[model samples]
Target: MRMNFGHLRGVHVRVFVPSSPYFPAYAQGQGPPPMVQERFQSVISQLFQYRIIRCGGAVDDDMANIIVAQLLYLDAVDPNKDIVMYVNSPGGSVTAGMAIFDTMRHIRPDVSTVCVGLAASMGAFLLSAGTKGKRYSLPNSRIMIHQPLGGAQGGQTDIDIQANEMLHHKANLNGYLSYHTGQSLEKINQDTDRDFFMSAKEAKEYGLIDGVIMNPLKALQPLAAAAEGKDQGSV
Candidate 1:
């Protein structure tokens, strides 16, 4: 059976399932050697329940570049599918993460995001960028939110430059958070002024997440599929 992940942002979602026929043809290696392919598929299959995809430790130009590229690819591939994004990261570049947030918002996916382990800092922004029905960690998983930080050298001049850039990030971050979580901009600003990590229960209570899922990594796609099916039934 073919499993469709549905659509996001006018783009129909697609998954490069390890168990598919495309794997053998496109997976060239060094990417795989002998029985390595089977083992690799097994491992990836274990993770397959989720739309769980990883992001870099912090936002960087590289990750920004990826968000753009992936957006384009998703656009080109399908325009009527909803996309589910699975995230776990300590967070990285603010500029990069902002770009990611913009990219996600522009495309109007029936987006849903889940945090399995660490969705901290800018990563939290990405999590909220989801279209709706956001979910998060239950047990040991965490979600951290705080003001953007920057690296500065030299003296006053560097500090000024960094501060200006930080203001820009804060504006963008708060805008995204306000729209998705329906919290006031001032409240988000206050919450993020200091780094805050939320437990699943706390996140749900504050509307940072829609619900809490146990063992998120293992249930990513399956839950999405189930939800999709449920939505279809209701329709």
Candidate 2:
């Protein structure tokens, strides 16, 4: 079935729930029951309405593709609205992470990144790259930054090429971190040489995030108040 949310008009979300192969009912061709499809569609519609994107697990090409699409689509739907991204990732694939980062900046809507748990390596980079003054982390979340990790198992020439590419990526990433965190290039390079971890408060002091979210309700009060004010004005 096609699901369309009011905020996400013109965006047709198709819910496809494949029948479980192991289920005996499926073997008889009684497939993905209507209830399952409705549930999936409902969740998708809600996510569209809320404009919430989640980045969990490793940052790979597939994950990056989805995020980029979501960011672009949401911006097209409503650029005035802010997009909230919840990041809890171990980090992987520098290219993939860069894709998401660039798209986050390229879009018209402001992207607010929240570190719900651990944001390590490229994950930390993306967390820091969010719109300035909007990056946040939960009180107990952990953030880590380090150089890109890679290995080569080929001929000497191939290994040399791979090494040079890794160095290039490391330099670019260091520059990005310096720009985002207002830290010196030398300091960023030094801290990222190894696995440098920080608590949420430490990350805020280090300039990786604007604030540590100690109380979620308090943090959201401004938005709530703004909405209430708008409602009152409309009335």
Identify the candidate with maximal TM-score.
2
| TM-score to native of every candidate shown | 0.69, 0.77
Q: After superposition, how far is residue 62 of candidate 1 from its true place, in Å?
A: 2.5
TM-score of 2: 0.77
- The parts of candidate 2 lying over 4 Å away from their true place are 1-41, 218-235
Give lDDT tens digits, candidate 1, residues 1-235. 1111111123555533233221343434435466876886676455433333345344556656755666655555665565556676667666567677777767644556666677787777787677566444445667878876655566898778866776776787777788778889999999988777687677766667776664335454533553543332111
RMSD (Å) per prediction: 10.9, 11.0
**What range of 10 consecutive residues in model 2 has the weakest lDDT sum?**
1-10
Candidate 2: what lDDT?
A: 0.75
- Candidate 1 weakest lDDT stretch, 10 residues: 1-10
Instruction: Output the lDDT of residue 208, model 1.
Output: 70
Candidate 1 Cα deviation (angstroms), residue 52: 6.1
At residue 135, what lDDT does model 2 achieve?
A: 80
User: How would you encode candidate 2's per-residue C-alpha lDDT over 1-235 as one tens digit per residue?
Assistant: 1110011124676543222211113334455777885776676567657887778766777778878988999999999888877788878778888999999989998888788888998889999998887788888899999888877658899888888888888899999999999999999999988889899989988999887766566344322222233221111
